[model samples]
Target: MSVSARDALRMAALYVVLSMLWLVVAGRVLDHLFDGSVAMAVGSHLSSLIWVLASAVLIFITRARLLSFIGLGTRRRKQDSERLRMAEAVFDTTLEGVLVTDRTGLIVHVNRAFMRITGYQQDEVLGQRPSKFKSGHHGPEFYRQIYTSLAQTGEWSGEIWNRRKRGEIYPQWQTIRAIRDDQGEVSHYVAVFSDISAIKHSEQELAYLAHHDPLTGLPNRLLFNDRVEQALGTAQSHKRGCALLLMDLDHFQSINDGLGHTLGDQLLKRVAERLSHWLGAGVTLARLGGDEFGVLLERCPHVGEAASLARDVIEHMKEPFSFEGHRLFISVSIGISLFPSDALTGEQLLRNADSALFKAKANGRADYALYTEELTAHAQHRVETAGELRRALEQNELRVYFQPVHDLTSGVMVGVESLVRWEHPERGLVPPGDFIPIAERTGLIGEIDLWVLRQACSQMMRWQAQGRSLAFVAVNISSRLFSQRGLYLEVAQVLAETGMNPALLEVEVTESAVMDDPEVSLEQLHRLRELGLRLAIDDFGTGYSSLLRLKRLPVQKLKIDQGFVAGLPDDDDDIAIVRVIIALARSMGMQVHAEGIEQAEQADFLLQQGCQLGQGYRFGRPMPADALKWG
Candidate 1:
């Protein structure tokens, strides 16, 4: 398919003829209409017509100069000196480099752009073979392919690497063509190329961004999984062992909330750097989304090696990270799964490691746990149970049971605690302990608490219509629900919808809920108190509540935790704690309420210890609203 000499000359003649005809016809027509000003305007930088004009001029110059530079331009003449000047300027100032060689592949003619791009002078490249520009990046086969394509197709265009005069290799997008004469014989070779180094650099940067996290410059989840798959393959092939460790920064959300997100992002970068520093050779570390990091040990020979590494990571994270003159303390929890034992596939391995990580966090943060069958079973159960609980709520299978809160001295039921019970069709009545924890963990407790609150308000209105002597009905609010900003608004709406008095509604929040964020919790509590509702801190001694914060709470009642009340009369330690709580409640002008008074002796001791209100199985177990009785 090599272009013949006659055809090449014919095409070149046609291009020049068309360009000259356009210039003559349009330039004369516009000159007659606009007094030649338009013609001059179209010939300058503001004109889009310069590209076609310049291309036609370049082809004419290449043919004439190409023959003259190789000593075969006997018929070439300077009939148009002005046009030649314009063509020469185009050849000199064009951005793309142009080179012309004889049929022998000797360099005969080069434009100014060729010298600028190749960093060579005209005298340096003249009379030399084009092969002198070879960069040594491509082998003999690469050049052979180029020659083969050019010989068969008459032209070749592709990306190539070439050397500059300064010996620096750079990429170029080049096109080379064989020029032929009227006798159908090859006369010279012409090449056009542009330095594409910037484009190549941009592509490399884009590829790196695709696989690495921009914030921390660590491998992202996509790359992390790929590395995990590779490690697993290597381990399987060599019959070695691999371990996948997933680490999470405990209480990271608190830090992010207290400080700004800018500092939080910087903290994450520092954490990634720390983890990378502590990682040993052959370990692949990655950032698996927010506040989570994954590590792969491809050569974990012993099972204890994974444990030791997890311990090291946790201990290193225990050291405070300093940023902007602030020392921020954080802890890490790690979960590990071994290859060929815990899981065979990467997906299963990550899932199992995450389950173990849940166990580590549950056991109290700053710890590590290994994968086990029980962990998988527990994870499956949680998933299945959460789904079932969602269906049960939608089907209205949830029922509220009431437990009486009795006055200790008079043994009169003053209030009822509304506790939720899931009446499963297949499992009968599911206990609160069985499903309540699941609800809390899955974040369904917020919805369930709101539903129970609405149900309790409606039931309270019914009880009031029945002339019951109960002063108030208490409903337990999970910490997840109690911390919500809209809790007060929801309660207000429920009261308005049910026509129930807010004064008779006692919302019981756990001590941990109030202590979670004292300032925010205080604001929420004050909002609820403004609605004329009673607030009580339940499970009082189980959390770390400072006396200073406790004094600022707008609550009127303290329900002592059942764990402290379980050993009331016999255990001296329980006896002292019960007395102190009663005194603490009285000193704050708050009513004292004790939970889990199962024994008569415990009730008598609590009453003697100045605990006014108490609730337990001894008085009456949790039952339906209609079944509740006071004696």
Candidate 2:
């Protein structure tokens, strides 16, 4: 029995004994004091009264003590019931699943959350062991480690995978604690756990996004570099060779510019898929960035293997891709670099491969090239030229060369096509072909175009001041500059600054440039035309120009590409194409200007075809502004 119950029993026994003693002593005193019947009766009554009074007094005292004990016991029982109610409330309402298990690991009690999380009823798991829910992902050693930690520290918490009642495995964060009795001996284990599958899935997705390109679903630059390092390391260990191929799609920018970014993104995805399909085992293809892809070939036996793979990739790319009802043809230029032969390290290998890729692009598209030491010299020269070009404007090394355009009927110089020439201090004069593409690729072409415009306008103003009559000064605008948002404003500013008539300053844009985002081009061209400036399409036949769309363009002249003009009257195909272009331009109320008129017969053929204006070396080679003699 408990100490409080024992004390109560002892006190009750003492009270009973004391009452008996009082009754006995009172009876004895009454018998001794009375002898006669009447006296005895009175004494008996008195004794009886005394006995009754003493019994009532004893009952009052014991009742008071018993009442106090009962009240104390009732309060204690109420407090114990309240505590049990609060504990049960917490056990049922908590979010974390709770399980109470005996020392033998047998589940005895579980909360509502436990049933919700594990899909198991309280009756179902009451006598079952926790192993019944095991996903088998954790081996014997894992449980051994858990038990060891629990035994030593009396508590353990970690992430664990477990199976639900439906056999679906999921991860959970769990904490198990040993519950000890007052004697400090463990009696049961209390476990609390929460499902963390969603968190785990989110983490996995984040990891995937970090290493992959969102658009192409291919390995990004960071992952590609890591793979290259691993491939190189493996090749080194086995004394084998590996190859790194860097590829760039030819004319991808034209497609991107012509069609929209949406189509461009779709094209990239298709390219990635085709490249991935062409690659076999041990080859890793990754979209390094933009239109460029990186391929790593591990344990490549020979340089021929890399070359063969490159050819296969190129051949596969030749097939037309159909997207959104549009048939598109694309090609790839590839560059290969071998391990140990090119350079050590991933960066160096990529650099060398890129150098070879540059060489391939320079030679022409739809080709592949292996890294050569000589290509490094060319790349270094390009780098030097790029730096020199940046300083060309500041150093006054840039000059405007005007080529005379003649009126075919009168054989008179009517206008000048303004061209830019970079007079490098060391190189004397760098041709436009040599540096123009470099400038375009490096994004310096826009600034060069702007400088050319300012210089051309200034020269025209100077010519007008000298009493020279000229119809117009045509200045070539790069695609980059043509697509700029504030191009019209910049042109207006230039015209105002140079004090030249906008009508005399004709801005020349290539057909491809105007065709890219025609809506935007149309808006910009309309804005330029609003300023009373003449717009002309340069190299007209070289691009994909829709005549239906061309009818809406605010252009006044079409210049035949020099390629067709070079052959002129001899090439039948050239003659037909030139005639059709002239008819097309004339029908649209646009003037036709034939470029590259090097011979009298070419001029005569163009004149016979009814083309009015022509320009080439036959009339006058491109000369500096001051050297020009007006006729």
Candidate 3:
């Protein structure tokens, strides 16, 4: 309604009201003036005067009601002007596209926000329906569902895609409320919409960051769990088996500790790259955190194929990487769990695969193990045994065993290998293999190694006290212990404390440990040798080593790997390698011993090859010190 038109109506109403009030006042005053007691001439004059006054009063009251309703008064006009201004500001400044429709759903009112949001001008949208902005982005069923909901509830809020002025379709959050008539009928709809495309983009970005490994940009533990659940469902539908393979980089912590986290992170990226490159389209590869990765092979045909793929992955990781000016070598221990074969649920599969991984590391690092019921049992037993071992070590239940290493050239005894023997009160003797690796991983190897050194020397001294021929006492150095900074110093201290001759104390180290960093190993060996002690390369053929480098070390002896000697006579490769190693040792002016000798032929062959030392089950298995009893 226009202000001019409203004012005209107010003026007309005021004129009518004033005219009525004038008539009422005039009627009453005329009655009073015409009273009988008054003279006719005087009453006539008074009646005329009263008639004028009543006419004036009627004009004033009628004018007041009309003017007030039309905002003619100062206070009313100011308030009305302020309200109109506030309404105009809201229509112009609100972010949502708002439109007020008439009873027939025709757009009667539109705001600037509507024009901006719908890509239409005031002329285009003023007479048109809100459906003008529909982009056909929604299906018929989708539209039907939304309309049905809106009709039933009289209010609807949802996401809708609408076309813009440039014909571009964009998603928006829309709220539609039914504008009701005074008679309670839904006369029209007031729709308010906001563009949510940016919000959607932000949500996607947040999801990616949350569920992926930042270092490798690969799916992390969160996403891995989702994939596992998906793979399980697929497997059930297809009646096929899925494999969950858990792989951990062996000795990754050592690499990080020795080099730095920067190098470690770089290595992880390289590993992730290789894994992603090798993974097939159907396989899901994700980092489970740190050095751990998970692979879900959905619809795998056979368990063997999963194992083969795992092996391939391990082989790929075995390749050397140049990280931070150092040739970094990494190996993976993979554990495989098959659906229906190992477990049923996602959690079960992951747990079983993890347990298998434990076995893989236990059997040795750089290997793979398949999940089985027996493996699960072994894992549980191990946990129990670890607890027992902890208590046993604390209670002085662990004792040292001595396996005599005899001189091959003569029928004389030489050094005895010191082996740890655990005697559980109820379970009797437990083998070293059952607990050694666990101890190493649990950070108990240092103490165990020290105890072995001290006990070995003490016993060797006891033998000397018995007037028996006291020979060199050999103690195996685990990789964990060998990697320590002051290993040689610790050994020298142990020997001095035991009052054992340094010449009779031999520290045996595996070839892998020494070859890990030859320069450092050589320095440590030299330090030990300078202490009047001996350094022997233990399990000689079990690791990668260069003869050229070995010659520079302070190594005085080579112990042929039990693997090579055990299969000798029948396995030509084993025999040939053993013979060549013995010849190499002889040429280097070092003694050679054939370990794991189990047969007469093997022992005789090793002796014929100029190997002067033999330590094996054929001679005597590792036995408790009390069990040795001068045998």
Candidate achieving higher lDDT, 1 or 3: 1
Would you list the rank order by TM-score, best first? 2, 1, 3
Tens-digit lDDT track for model 1 on 90-177?
8788999999899999999899999999999999998999899999999999999989998998899999999999999999999999
- How do the residues 568-628 of candidate 3 rate in per-residue lDDT, one tens digit apiece? 8889899789888998999999989778988878888888889898988888888866666
Worst 10 residues of 1 by lDDT: 70-79
lDDT of all predictions: 0.89, 0.91, 0.84
Q: Locate the minimum summed-lDDT window of 10 residues in model 2.
A: 251-260
> Clash pairs of candidate 2?
none
Candidate 1 has which clashing residue pairs, if any? 5-180, 5-181, 5-184
> Candidate 3 — which residues are off by over 4 angstroms?
1-214, 226-241, 250-262, 280-283, 298-331, 358-369, 437-446, 463-469, 496-499, 562-578, 596-609, 617-621, 626-631
Mind giving the per-residue lDDT tens digits that candidate 2 earns over 296-413? 9887778999999899889999999998998889999999999988878898999999989988898887999999999888778788888888898778899889999999999999
lDDT of 3 at 432: 77
Using TM-score as the measure, the top candidate is: 2
